[model samples]
Target: MVKHLIDEQINLNLLTPEKTLFTGEVSMVVIPAEEGELGVLPKHAPFATTLRAGEVKIYHNDNVSDVFTISGGFAEIVNNKCEIVADGILL
Candidate 1:
């Protein structure tokens, strides 16, 4: 089976206790970690971090595709996937 470009991207999911905010395949994601802004890409090393209240930036094709305002959260990165469980999201 041949893999396409989109299929090779990172899978991102942003969620809150009430609902899931976003879910898609993106090229890159910039998360607001407690330490600092952390950037995650395809094949990124597996890790997890706590997030502070800040903006979460999502990128596709090297451009800003979407942005979300999160009020603190936790992020987990594994197997080319990023799952974020936010305390709250300002929609």
Candidate 2:
């Protein structure tokens, strides 16, 4: 199906070994990478990175939608989809 520019979204999945924390569509996400905070938007290039202990911010409709605190983890982005495998989640 064809999608309009304004309707574009990225599938975000935040998960831990025990359970899934968040799974939905979002406009953007900010992750704490090894280097620093990394902002991920729709159509972002595919890559993987190790996350630092920090907050994961999910954005939608130009506003912050959800936030997750992780002790550390791994994140991967591919084809407008982002998945985070957290080692430990605080909330």
Candidate 3:
């Protein structure tokens, strides 16, 4: 199958003590970094930042997405992969 830009994904891994929230690919993600809102995509430059209590938007497609309220955490991106070890998360 062919992939559209919205379907052009990057690897993602989200973890918490209770369980692994997500592990796979996503089109894009918006994180609430402490400095400001961060928009991440595939092949993005290596990034690491602190997060604040806010919304985390995981975009799956043009018309589909998942949002979560994060209490706090750290986000890091490297080699087309994004990992988030959340302090606390609310679906």
- For lDDT, the strongest prediction is 2
What TM-score does candidate 3 reach? Answer: 0.85
Sorted by TM-score (best first), the order is: 2, 1, 3
Stretch of 10 with least lDDT, candidate 3: 1-10
Per-residue lDDT tens digits of candidate 3, residues 19-87?
787788988888899998998877789999988988888877654367778888999999999998888
Q: Report lDDT (Cα) of residue 48, candidate 1.
A: 96
Worst 10 residues of 2 by lDDT: 1-10
Tens-digit per-residue lDDT, 47-70, candidate 2: 999999999999886789789999
Off by over 4 Å in 1: 1-7
- lDDT of each prediction vs. the true structure? 0.90, 0.91, 0.82
**Candidate 1 Cα deviation (angstroms), residue 82:** 0.3
lDDT string, candidate 1, 1-91, tens digits = 1234434689999999999889999888899999999988888899999999999999886678889999998999999999999999876
lDDT at residue 26 of model 3 (Cα atoms)? 87
Deviation (Å) of 87 in candidate 1: 0.3
Candidate 3: the clashing residue pairs are: none
